[model samples]
Target: MYLFKKAKESIVSSLHGDKSSPIIKINYICNCILKITLAICLWLSSLSFLALYLNADIINKSLFQLFSLSSLILSCLSFIILKRKNGTYILAKIKMYPFSFKDLVDVSLLTGVVTISVFDIILCYLYLLVAFAVFVIATCSIYECLDNPYMRDNENISSFSLSFISVLYMGLYVISNGVIFRNLPYNPLEYMGYIIKNIIEDIFSVTKKLTKLII
Candidate 1:
């Protein structure tokens, strides 16, 4: 937020520059902060995700591992494109607000995803998606009686990388009434799947019985 506010102020100030003040040149670096960010923070984030997947039982372990490894490699590759020497710009510091807006946004985005992965928020959100999808599918199938005109259930993956970043960096996972993922650490995959399936089916069975009154 501070970065955005500063950037916004810089833009407005630049448009109404004082002709009275003389212009000065500053050593200009393109995306210097992002270069530092990828070289350090994101590199660590990738390795951290890799370490987790290697030790923990991820749902799609191999793909997750590959994603992490690829990210780590990409962060390494960022150095190849780095500027060899600083360029010059007129009042560059004020013009760029210390760094480009994109640089800070990228940092924030990477940090958010890493936080989610580290805190296991992704796993929690996965089930939330599953439950929402299940409910939507069920309700949509019975839409005529329910009078819901908005009736569509879709998953965006095979067709879309979901901003491409999603499939590549922060992968999306979906389960259709499957085992709770966190349970994999404790129960056998098969047993866990069975438990969740039964629970969902039983809930629906009861719902079906009660819905007879609504119909």
Candidate 2:
């Protein structure tokens, strides 16, 4: 009983702690919504992909459209909430607070677990895509938090490395998803060559477009 009371107090204190600022609260809420939406998308994508793979006629077009629309709406809502609540104007004034990248990772893991439990299947590829989306959002939030002039001096190499890796992972996951969506032949070793080739081509294409715009 004593331990339980102490634990309850700890929980309350943690929620009401100084780290629980308005911006942090908004970030958490937005992340939660995005995580839920990503889970739905993963489930729907998995179903569709499996149906396509097995030549099953179970693909319900109406249901797929509904899920896709909901996912898009929720994704937009998360973005709007973060922007309106922590717009550049307000973010500029905030000093460095205790931000936990680990918490974001934990949320991502929880999302994957819940998605699998609810869907009763493991769609590794789609799961990676969903996680990539989560990580991209997390990376953006970290960037915004670190954008404050106050944090500029305090930023460390480790945080920057993590952000860079998150972006890299997002890009790879997107490429993998594209490959799978196109129903390309995927032998791990062989498919990697294709993935790398496509990535290089995409980089050159983007660079060309940017150069044209600059000129």
Best by TM-score: 1
- Candidate 1 residue pairs in backbone clash: none
Across residues 1-215, which tens digit of lDDT does each residue of candidate 2 receive? 43344455445656677644544544343345344544554554454344334443322333333333443543444344334523221221111111211111111122222111211111222333445555555455356436634435443433343334334434544654443334333455655665566567667878998999999
Whole-model lDDT values for every prediction = 0.36, 0.40
Question: Candidate 1 residues 112-170, lDDT tens each?
Answer: 22111212222223323432443343233233323422222234221121123332222
lDDT of 2 at 53: 46
Sliding window of 10 residues with minimal summed lDDT for model 1: 113-122
Off by over 4 Å in 2: 1-133, 150-155, 184-215
